[model samples]
Target: MTTAPVIGPEERLPLGAAEADPRTATRRRYLMCEPRYFTVSYSINPWMDPSAPVSTDVALRQWHELKATYERLGHVVETIEPAAGLPDMVFAANSGTVIGGRVLGSRFRAVERAAEADHYRRWFVERGYRDVVMPESINEAEGDFAWTGEVLLAGTGFRTDPGAHAEAQEVLGVPVVSLRLVDPRYYHLDTALMVLTEADPTTGRRAQIAYYRDAFSLGSQRVLRHLFPDAVIASDVDAACLGLNGVSDGYNVVLPREANRLATELTARGYNPVMVDISELRKSGGGPKCCTMELRD
Candidate 1:
């Protein structure tokens, strides 16, 4: 069955300056859903090893520990019901991009994940979010779109279309910078780059990023270097363990325990690295960031 694309404007809007000043950044509130039906039933990305055995009990235990860690650090964590037949729904970051209480719902490119758009939309609406902008183009929300400093860093050349970059800018009312992914292993932008400080509230507009340079194209690498000269470049070993697929709160960076080098580098830069074991989820090409979605109000 063919599904008609959600009709919307597709023109690339003019890039604007960063939106919110990071100096006032506060503890971010996030949403996460328990892995009720989490399993790699199909091979979508390079990480999915369906032949390998999966332990739902282990995945649930790890997910709970991660949630507890967030609460322990004094962050508000919200939950949503995981629908059946949507195993990938555990990765809430792909649901949408939230800005100023508005959510630009993701229109997934994969047919297996297509139904996710509406489910997430209803969840937002029921939770009192009125401004939900659905897109016509294929964009994977926070998975392929994230905010760093005042601009939205969008990913393409894999799960997302370059045309969606413009749509996001127009709908989200923030300037978006495009980054192209080269490696199939790092199919999503979140897997290649991690936002460290989105406008450090303590310092000011100063922002930081941790990324794997080789995951991007030559042009994208140049753009990243020009934009963030002091960006933390992850080692090949760390990147292999999905170290770049992490979540940061401007103070604490939550990553997999396998990312030892990244943790050391983060500590050297005066950032606390909280290691968690989400190896079960890693079997599906996701990590800390994939399990959480920041909702900025």
Candidate 2:
């Protein structure tokens, strides 16, 4: 059985932001989910990864428009300082864990990535999230984590380690299902899996994952199987054009403006979708999901 981590109810949205009509607001709120505080990183040359960077210029435009889309959505965006002499810091969103009202900051696996966690910590603390724990023994990255109404699953052997998993589980008083990660380019779980749309207690698996279905070895499959025994596998055509990484809210998805077919399908399904041209950012092997941090879940 996978280790089960119990999650607590998320607190009400922070008080300082200006109030808006919830009815007209584009920001979608999960009934039991809200991200109290969040941070984001910009892109640099990302061609180091072979799978990414097929189209560089188109991806960058989309990355900028992604920022604008979120700003229009009312998420309080916090920017991190550029790491000195880096090719890409866009994946820095995965540096910590928020569980049971406590935020645990972690050490990063990549040497170039270590500074990002500290930046996240300051931002979280400023927002007054209590019970924050600075990780000492292990490295933890967001790619290793998946949240469900019932538990938080953290993976090992990828960017995050088993030591970090155990620490988070104990601090949050929830069972954390730990599994070994598949290696070589599914470096972050987000590359392989992401919840494109999420309701209060349920989440939609985006078609983007189809791009990586053949990559995982054995154990990670067991981890996925444990949770999504009946998950509907998405199709390839839907996966590539869907801007699956750019999903926001349970009802809305942010996508590249060029994805007409997928956008048409989403609108037909009752989603209020938004599109930004991120061709330049994609050149570095990232998509909409790589740029913005979802603050209100």
Candidate 3:
């Protein structure tokens, strides 16, 4: 994969009137898992260090605050019980990708997180999600797959397998655009990119996004530039803080408090930035988006 080119302020795309207009927040339905058994006892990604100290109590508190943030925004928040010994289960976004009541379950690349897929699949089945499917290929669900209204942007090269991209397209029946990730730090696509405003073909409102350009391969960066010309480009400081690992309901964006620069950029783009401190859970490399899974029913 080719390295991404350095983009300066002068090279940034100019914001148009449509981008400056105030955004509308849509009420959504989401699925979450409490960090009842949260911990970083095993190393999987670059953020995990087994030797580092952890506090389950702190993780629980932070996770609760995140859940409350969603409820406060008028979004329905549903939760699954955190299974014992499944430490990373709290990062529920990996559970699956639910679209129009059809669920595409995850097949985790790590053994430590493998069992999580079944639990999430069962949740959808038990809730009467008739079209739920457990993927045969290895994929990390929403952690590596993001819906942009018109197409699904998928990432591979670290956690999720490249083969899963085609598998998801067949399962969801939506066009999939494969983007290769080059950075290990941003192991999942959601860690390096986020969809800010989904496309609205009726209103001619194009999909808007924000991403860490360096996390993607050069060709992937070009694709992103073509798809979203006015996409927000995150700085190194914001990307390191997992700023791009945020959830946006078109208008209100919930993100980590440490990503100050990203918050400022979102505000300039006419989005309401809601900050939450989940530093305790960050020990395992997760944020708001990581903990929450949007359920499109």
Candidate 4:
């Protein structure tokens, strides 16, 4: 992968104005759940406020739009039945990470989400995929782990344990780059960084990523700078709105409408910035990426 210098100050653009680049034509399979059981039953992150009222109806509508957008882009959208009591199950990305058809299921740290780990594992196994459930450490699957084509970018210091890094490396048979999550707001690595693509279509190299620098520890920040020097750094306003929690299919980046600055930067990069409003889901500290999980076949 080629590295460029860190981004400098730039002007923001209007939301959803970015043109889609045809070069980014990679289609992926994704898993999602309707927000039928979604609600802020408890506060696990800074974005969640238990006292705040949640509208399940509005949440479902927004989630539907997100699914429609993915389908419009020619990506396969699969469903996992939402259980009655697991409100947070709508955040499908937390279930696990799938690479090379192998699944490493999550072990949620929060008591409320503990049961979800097994449910997700069963779904993968039932589909005939190999599922490995970590027996010892706490790890929230794709929430803290990202695949960069060549290596796995694992996050620690907030939700996932550092010990899982070695385990992930052993299980996946790939090198793991352990990045530390320092900010309370961006608790998960997926919330702080969005993997744009696994490989650049033109260069045939590791694809790019966009991230919030302030969310990582100094050492992790250095690693990001060294590895993805040209990564689009999210502004405070965009980062605060959960803009980095996005899903990309090489050409189009699907993110929140509030992330105008991020949309502008992505537009300038010869890629498409597909914006969607999932404000209702944000009450539970998630956005577009949280609602979807990439399943490699």
In candidate 2, which residue ranges exceed 4 Å CA deviation?
1-61, 81-83, 137-140, 197-212, 230-244, 255-273
Candidate 1 vs candidate 4: which has greater lDDT? 1
TM, every model = 0.90, 0.64, 0.93, 0.90
- Please, what are the lDDT tens digits per residue for candidate 4 over residues 54-133? 99999999999899888877788999998888999999999888888777888888999998888888888888885555
lDDT of 3 by residue, 1-297 (tens): 001111221122334254654476777889999999999989999999999999999999988888887777778899998899999999999989987777899998899999999899889888888999888889999999999999999999998898999999999999999999999999999999999989888878789999999999999999999988999999999999998999888877888988889988887787778888889888999988999999988
Top candidate on TM-score is 3
For model 1, residues 29-91, the per-residue Cα lDDT tens digits are 888989989888888999998899998889999999888877765578998898898888989
Candidate 4 global lDDT? 0.83
The best-first sequence of candidates by TM-score reads 3, 4, 1, 2
lDDT of each: 0.84, 0.50, 0.88, 0.83
- For candidate 3, report its TM-score: 0.93
lDDT against true structure, model 3: 0.88
Error of 2 at 157 (Å): 3.7
Error of model 2, residue 90, in angstroms: 3.6
